[model samples]
Target: MSYHNKVVLVTGGGTGIGRATALLLAERGAIVAVNYSRSAAEAEETVQAIQQFGGQAIAIRADVSSNEEVVTMIKHIVKRFGTIDYLVNNASITRYIAMEDLDAVTEEAWDDLFAVNVKGMFNCARAAAPYLKAGKGAIVNVGSIAGMTGKGSSLPYAVSKAAVHGLTKSLAQALAPDVRVTGVAPGAVNTRWWAGKEEQMRALIRHLPLDRISAPEEIAALIAAVLEQPSMTGQILTIDNGQTL
Candidate 1:
């Protein structure tokens, strides 16, 4: 129960990596705020699961891209939990668009992707920084192996995640004396996010030394470890099974 009595905010917690991280943290005794956009029912399901496990949790609906909404969400969570001990920026967007369909990757697409993948991460971090510093908390951002290499569904997605890694480093330097900031760059985790594209993902994973994709819980384990280790900060831990090499 390293996180017993701690409050953790997880954006996009309704599904995928975010959902796994939220549930795992709750099971380990952290009070979780399950943040979701357009997935109220799913978020509530996550909350219910935590309650059934005798853990504390609440479902919060907020589009992480909105600064106002993010601020309000953080305020509400702080009001309820007293303080935020950790914040996991796991919300991101990706779309499958071919390079030939340049129109498909329009300004709106770029903006939309950045709005969630990049701005959302920043907004949440800004809103939660004060409480995090107060609690000597940690920030774990969800980056991607796509950010480190040229392998994502879209160019914008890869760019946005790369920006996340930069954000992790900058924030860690800025908040070092008071808080810890780190990013987890996962490689081809098995989740609904990639459910229908197993073949493409398999080919991608084959290039990795492990020759297999990672599970959400496998990535969750690294995130939990980062939260537990007070000394690890300003680092992007890639759980890619040596994909980078």
Candidate 2:
């Protein structure tokens, strides 16, 4: 279907991969709701950029981990846009604790990670399911290569994304023939997500098959491509520069 005037919600659409996805989808004629948890300014910037490009967009501040907040956000979106055509669960969090550092991987840390990475996706999906089904829309979750390899910034993060992968499939099955659910597991990309790991990120880039980390736009394009496919559901596509290979 043509993206013209289609309504899409992108969680964590303030910066990084989420921001890129929001912009690209808006540019392609989709009316986007850019959701942000703490990056309100960044979300506003994204909305401005979309509007400047002659696309329809709005910046929404909502914590996906909160069911009440997610429900409210959905109500507002439907109130404003009339209906939702797509849902992109791009909100997530991670800890930089080394895998061997079990001491640092506290219960609180695990809780925080799963609350955002896994539960947040669930909250959003549950809230948006009806609207999506009404429009015969789809959901594209943002997962991580760590989920598949059981390797990432921390053990908890990897576990959370693995849950996301599982959730994607289960959700596809539950909401099937109506609102399709899928995901993309992207490896390291140069975004603000790597706050203090600049040197490490650079070092790792040399070892990637592509000789460079994936760009946010590149991943966003893949997300858009996935949304364009009608027969895909319950699948998680990887864009890791062959890092897992």
Candidate 3:
């Protein structure tokens, strides 16, 4: 995709899939706005790496769940890059616990997950809607296969991602002819979420038709393709290696 001079905002761009998406856009000549909540150092690293590769990038710290912060982030991006051409809502949170262990899934856990996963996306979208409309931009939400089928993480996480799917469709309908919105639901990505328990991870992979988990870059490739496909909108592209099937 020709991203020359395009302004792309990626939430949670400090690491994992968000970082990968930012880098991919930057490599394609997009002006990447790397958004982070608390990972200042990591976000800086992502920006620096893009700079090293002769790509334009800037790191902005904002709690995406906060309307004021999201507004500020969009303002900063517009001030720097003119207008937003793409938005990658990749910021999310999760806490794994059994249904019987209600204590493990505290009210705080639910609040935190929803705040970042669902509310954060909403805030960013709300703030960026105007600029996106002006620029005819696209939104690519990072959902999870868990949202489509069963509980891949905690109940809160699954619910939040399902909301993301709904948000993607609704936004697509609302912003049609001006802006496009879609979701990319990945399954069993090899990120920090599965740091330890290699045995369990391996066992989980064995059941997959592809017999492996997805890499962050693999997901980034999908984001790049979606950005290029102008006719496609409101679609949830599932990248689960046929696991869900």
Candidate 4:
């Protein structure tokens, strides 16, 4: 579909992958809604950048972990943009804990991780389902290579991402022939989440075929490509520089 007049909502659009996706989509002519939880400054900055470039955009505050908040956020977007064309469920959270430290993976931490990484996805998708269906829109959920290999920072994080992949497939089937649903599972990206683990990240990248971690913008571009494919659904594209191999 033509992005020139499409309306898009990007969760966690304040930083890293979300920010990159928001900016890129705005550049392509879409009216971007940048959603943020606590990163208000960053989200505002992103909106300003898009505006400066003569693109339509706005900053929305919401906690994806809460269904009520997500519902309100989607309604606000619809009120502002008339209708929705795309939803990018890119908000996620993870803790840097060694897999060996079983005690560190507390029940609370697991719940928190799933709440944002998995439930947050379902929340926004459920809220925006009607609008998306009306517009024959698309959704791109940001998953993780850790979900496929069970090799992320913690067991909870990996489990949550695995849930995201399953949700993508399930939603594709459930919302079929109307709103397309897909996912992107990325390996390590050089984002804020990778902070304080530079040595480990470099070590991991050395074994990858690409020998470099993905940039947030690179991942965003791929997400957009996935959304652009009208006939594709129920597929989780992997962009991990062959790290899984």
Tens-digit lDDT track of model 4 for 25-79: 9999999999999999999999999999999999999999999999899889999
Off by over 4 Å in 1: 99-103
Local lDDT at 186 for model 3: 95
Lowest lDDT sum, 10 consecutive residues, model 1, at 97-106
What's the alpha carbon RMSD for model 2? 0.9
Regions of candidate 2 where Cα sits further than 4 Å from its true position: none
- Each candidate's root-mean-square deviation in Å? 1.4, 0.9, 1.1, 1.0
> Residue 245 in candidate 4 has what lDDT?
85
The segments of candidate 3 whose C-alpha lies over 4 angstroms from its true place after superposition are none
Error (Å) of candidate 1 at residue 154 is 0.4
After best superposition, candidate 4 residue 24: deviation in angstroms?
A: 0.5
What are the models' TM-scores?
0.95, 0.98, 0.97, 0.98
Write the residue-wise lDDT of candidate 1 on 103-168 in tens digits: 678788789999999899999999999999988999999999888896677877888889999999
**What is the per-residue lDDT of model 3 for residues 1-245, given as tens digits with 9 covering 90 to 100?**
68999999999999999999999989989999999988899999999999999999999999987889999889988988788988999998888877456578888988888888988998998889998999888999999998988576677788888999998999899889898898999998888878877787899998999988999999999999998888999999999888898
Assess each prediction's global lDDT (C-alpha) against the native.
0.90, 0.94, 0.90, 0.93
